[model samples]
Target: MTGNPTSRDYNKASVLDVLLSRAPLTRIELIELTGFSKSTVSRAVEELRADGCVVNGGVDEVTGRGRRSTYLDVPGTMGHVVGISFGMRTTCVLVADLRGRELRHVIVPTVDHQEVRNAAEWLVGLMAEASKSAEGPLRQVVVAVPGRVLGGTEIFGPAESMKVFAGPGLQRALADLVNAPVLLDSDANASLLEILTDDATLEDAALFSMSSSLSFASCIDRELLRRRTPAFGDIGVLFSGVGNEVLDGLLSTSGLLRFARGRGLDLERIDDLWLHPHEEVSRADVLDAFTTAMVTAVSAVAVTLDPGSVFFVGRLRPLVDEVLPEVRRRLDKSLATAPEVKAPTQVLGLSVARGAVYACLGMARDRLRDAVLEARRQGQHTEQSAPAF
Candidate 1:
């Protein structure tokens, strides 16, 4: 007769889940936390250890106890996950262990001219370089792009500079090169993942990436609202109240530069637009237009979603300090309820990569748990098939 599937598998999974959440715990603590008997916890830990999923940590010091307890933890040597933020200006890559501890972080300028295959090769090289310290093979990779992701395998509507990634080819290439599963998602969605990680209580929140392109993502009831449709979250195309200009044409970094140039300001960089002589009337005019467009976009999102909070991220983060007050003031004047608007604490590019890591951690955990259970079952089969001693 077949044994109950949940008998041992469920115990092992529960123990692993606890260690993943709170590691370096003792056997006594595991027994107490899981409400399982000592034998059950011991069996689970032994099986996990045999499968290389768990390892012994330091011994806990005892005050006046009979013995010292050895702490058990999910081993970092089990494997690692990679998070990549492929942006127009720069790409950020982060390597983290199954426990969510960062092992490597790198930021490099993006080559805008590379084709999909070339870009995949270049990124694989970077991933290999970043994961040198990882003791085991790569388990999962999540790539963040400034575009719409369909079914986590295809890319669409990427920004102009990153148009090379707009298709399923890049994801397929990366999966082939890395010999591991790969997932693609919008950079804005990745940012929202990072935010949700910081504060799990947040149910409804929106994020706006005001960089080379204007992108948006939202979390409703603690879940990211993802769609397979093309241009699903491209808030940049929303019509700005100003003379047929879309929000992207007026509020994005490129849009801001174009507006400044139209005002006769010879600005070569975004920094220059903000650092121009305070006495220049044209610079002030550009700021006014930028703030007006921001207020309009934010008010629309606030009224529609009624999110509890709104976040501004990416290249325009520096301008938040100057423009936020006006945004809030204008929203207060027009809307009955305005979401709390602010900038995230982490840098734009790194946050995208970190969020990708958060997005893949669950998958990695599931893979680990299944491997442990399978190893146990195989061992049992081998024993049953052996002749009696």
Candidate 2:
């Protein structure tokens, strides 16, 4: 049976997440903040310490009673979480801890592209290298792809451009190579999640990435609004031939090629093209596209969720800055009647990889909490069921 989330599981994982995000907290503080029982909190903390997942951070000087007890800290190298972004051109591999700090990385050319065989062979080798080096075994892999994946199928899917993953058993084949649980998500979705990094304060945001190909992803109320074709945000497709069009038409590679040429860079193809946000040459072109695209994308969001901000997370930041002024100008021009679109358009690098870890780590943490809590509940039920002497 597929495991669905329980309220208890979410609560327990959230507790661990908060404790790990900041400095140590006393059992009293944890109880008050997490609304967990002192006894239950003690057990959880003890289990965390036993697993070596947490340690004594420091003692509270303000607490006058007793030893003032120490708080828990999640150290580096706690567990291995792998993030793979297989773009149109390159395969970027990053392995990190539960807190999302790097352990070892293997970033090589995208010689494989969409070919399952090519990617699987190269990735298998990379996995072996990572496994041998880590003190702990690989726990999970969160792979982000730059295409539309729907119904758990990777080939002949919504992403019409590339067909490399069209081969048989893409997920299973990769899992066989890594020997760990693997989670697959769209590059846009993964980038969006990675950039956000479980920050609940962020309610609504959209990310535009020119990694493998030009694409966008948006989240509303912190929940990813999905579709059958893994489609979240498609401003490139939407802004095509629209009013004062600035973005490349999704149906036209020539449009993207021309867009590249407009900035004085003639990239042969979108394969592994790392769109920088700061390069002066491409700055003007990117900004024009960013302005039109952001206006269209944010306009869509405005009509729906009306978010706080839109963050752009990718490799190129300076190039992104060039576009921000224009993006703001367009947003102002188009949404004159809509709610004020004042949120800054951000360009965050390597955020997608980090977000992938948080997403997967959150799941893994929830799983561990459930395993322990279920055992406790079972024990309690057994005690109540026993006959009295």
- Backbone clash count for every predicted candidate, in the order shown: 0, 11
lDDT, candidates in the order shown: 0.81, 0.58
TM-score of each: 0.91, 0.72
Error of 1 at 370 (Å): 4.0
Highest-lDDT candidate: 1
Per-residue accuracy of model 2 over 1-389 as CA lDDT, tens digit each: 22344454445445666665553677778888877788767766665555555677788676555666777767654556777766554566777765555677766665634566566778777656755556454667776776555543453232344564753356767877766687776666777776466466777776656543456667777887666754434455555434455453422344545565656765665322344334565745544554555466667667676666665544434444556667666667767544433333332324555555666676655554555446444452212232010
Model 2 segments beyond 4 Å from truth? Answer: 1-29, 47-69, 73-78, 99-101, 131-137, 151-162, 166-168, 198-200, 229-235, 242-255, 260-290, 313-320, 337-349, 376-389
TM-score of 2: 0.72
State which candidate has the highest TM-score. Answer: 1
Model 1, stretches more than 4 Å misplaced?
A: 1-4, 28-38, 61-68, 371-389
lDDT of candidate 2 at residue 169, scale 0 to 100: 58
Candidate 2 root-mean-square deviation in Å: 6.5
- Model 2 error, position 199 (Å): 5.0
Clashing pairs in 1: none
